[model samples]
Every structure is written in structure tokens, then in C-alpha cells.
Target: MIFGTCGQRAPSVGESAPAERRKYIEEHFRCISDCDMCGICAVYHNQDPLLVYRDYIEGTRTFEEITEEYRR
Candidate 1:
């Protein structure tokens, strides 16, 4: 799924995703040194970006569903 300000495709979550998926999620979605170019910090505000996307990364929920929670 495509998420965050970078517009990169997120790694697909599968029924048996390996632990590396977590690293991929963190590296891609979490805040890096270049915060000005990434909008995730603003979207998550004081929340941890990893926590915000936990369900999706765990394959327990869709990215859309998690994002919809914030939209509401």
C-alpha cells in the first residue's frame, strides 16, 4: 500500500510476514533525519508513527482502516 508523504509503496503484509517487515515499516514510515520532506511527523503529531501503523504492519488490519481512524 502507498502511504506517507514519500508516496512509496509499502511492503505487502502477508499471512506469514517475517520480522523484517517491522524493520521495513519503521525505516520507511517512521521519522528520519529529514523531517521537513516527510509529512508523517505532522500526521502522527505526538503519537509514535510505529504505533499508529502497528495494526497494518502486523497484518491484523488494512492500511485504509488504520488511516480512517485518524480521519474520524
Candidate 2:
């Protein structure tokens, strides 16, 4: 089973993750600069940021459609 930045997001039904498992997984992502938490997180606190604003602007486009939208 492949997992990356977006893959491990499970829907919140109050199923608390095990402490060690959560720590292990969260450790995979690292800060790019001297700070932790990305820019959107530091400024707007957008905990749930999408991959692109264009995805929302295009309105209900399928993943393939969104992928094609960026290809131009």
C-alpha cells in the first residue's frame, strides 16, 4: 500500500491514532526552511489546504480533469 503526504488522511470519526504510529507517520514530513509548518499554515492557519486553488475554481472537476487543467 503506497502512502505519501496525502495518502494517510483518514476521515475523522474519533478514532484516535496510536501515539507511536502517529509519531512515526508525522515524522515523514519535514519543514523546507528554518521553520516548521509551511507558509499557509503559519499565516492563514489553513490546516486543510488543498493541492491547488484552481481545483476549487474549476468546480467539481474530476482528479483527471484537474490534472489536465494544470498541464497547459
The candidate that wins on lDDT is: 1
Per-model C-alpha RMSD: 2.8, 10.1
Report the C-alpha lDDT of model 2 over 5-63, residue by residue, as the tens digit.
55663222134334433342344333455445455345324332243322333333333
Please give, for residues 1-72, the per-residue lDDT of candidate 1 as tens digits: 446445855556664373555666677676665878766767776578678878877788766677777866
CA deviation > 4 Å runs, candidate 2: 5-17, 34-72
Clashing pairs in 2: none
TM-score (all chains, Cα) for each model? 0.61, 0.24
Judge candidate 1 against the unseen true structure and give its global Cα lDDT, from 0 to 1. 0.67
Worst lDDT run of 10 residues, candidate 1, spans 12-21
Off by over 4 Å in 1: 15-18, 33-37
